[model samples]
Target: MEKVKRKIIKIDEDLCTGCGKCVSPCAEGAIEIIDGKAKVRREQLCDGAGFCLGVCPTGALTLEERETVPFDEHAVHEHKKTLADKPEYNITMKCHLCGTTEHDRPLLPIKAKGESDWVCVKCIPRLIHG
Candidate 1:
């Protein structure tokens, strides 16, 4: 089958600090920082919505157009869940209450509709009770 053309985001090695700040938001698991630079696993997995672009503070990542290997979305979803099961770096913003790591915690359950970015459920009360 012919590969699909998509915009893949690559982190400039010279610029990335290996902060790992971009991993959680990527639902496709396309971006992984290796040697302190973000690398796209497969362009086909990337939707090119640029969500990672906004989260990156270092400006190390950028989108480039090219042909990419095709990937099944359903398969990617299954893969993401598997990866999530592992105890990896937590990306969710810190919880306000107990000062716990939010990691992959869902945003809605942790905070008001739009009060703050996603946090942990444990901190929700403090955020709300306060």
Candidate 2:
């Protein structure tokens, strides 16, 4: 197959902490934590929507145009199916406080002492600042 220039997710290994925050935001299941680092499992599976970019606290993920093989829809479908078959694959991310699964707003990481949790952007002031 001939390579073409297209947008794709790029991860900076030096910046990534492998926190697994970006894994759930990716609807395509293209991102995975391997060897304590975030990796793009398959280029074709990434739609380049950049949803994962929002959840990355370390700013390790970004989109860039590069020459690569065209996205394969068949491969994406297969990859999704494979992920779906796994019992641990969860698509919904819920707020740690309100127990709601809605993610329409940006999420913020709140850390106190040695523990950390994610709060939706709407709940930041009420939950953290207050």
Global lDDT of each candidate? 0.63, 0.78
Query: How many residue pairs clash in all the candidates, one count each?
Result: 0, 0
lDDT of 1 by residue, 6-59 (tens): 766766888777777678767677677776667776556677766677566667
Model 2 bad stretches (over 4 Å) = 85-88, 95-98, 103-130
Which 10 consecutive positions of candidate 2 have the poorest summed lDDT? 108-117
Query: For residue 93, what is the lDDT in candidate 2?
Result: 71
Clash tally for model 2: 0
* TM-score quality measure for candidate 1: 0.61
**Candidate 1, pairs of clashing residues:** none
Q: Give every collision pair in model 2.
A: none
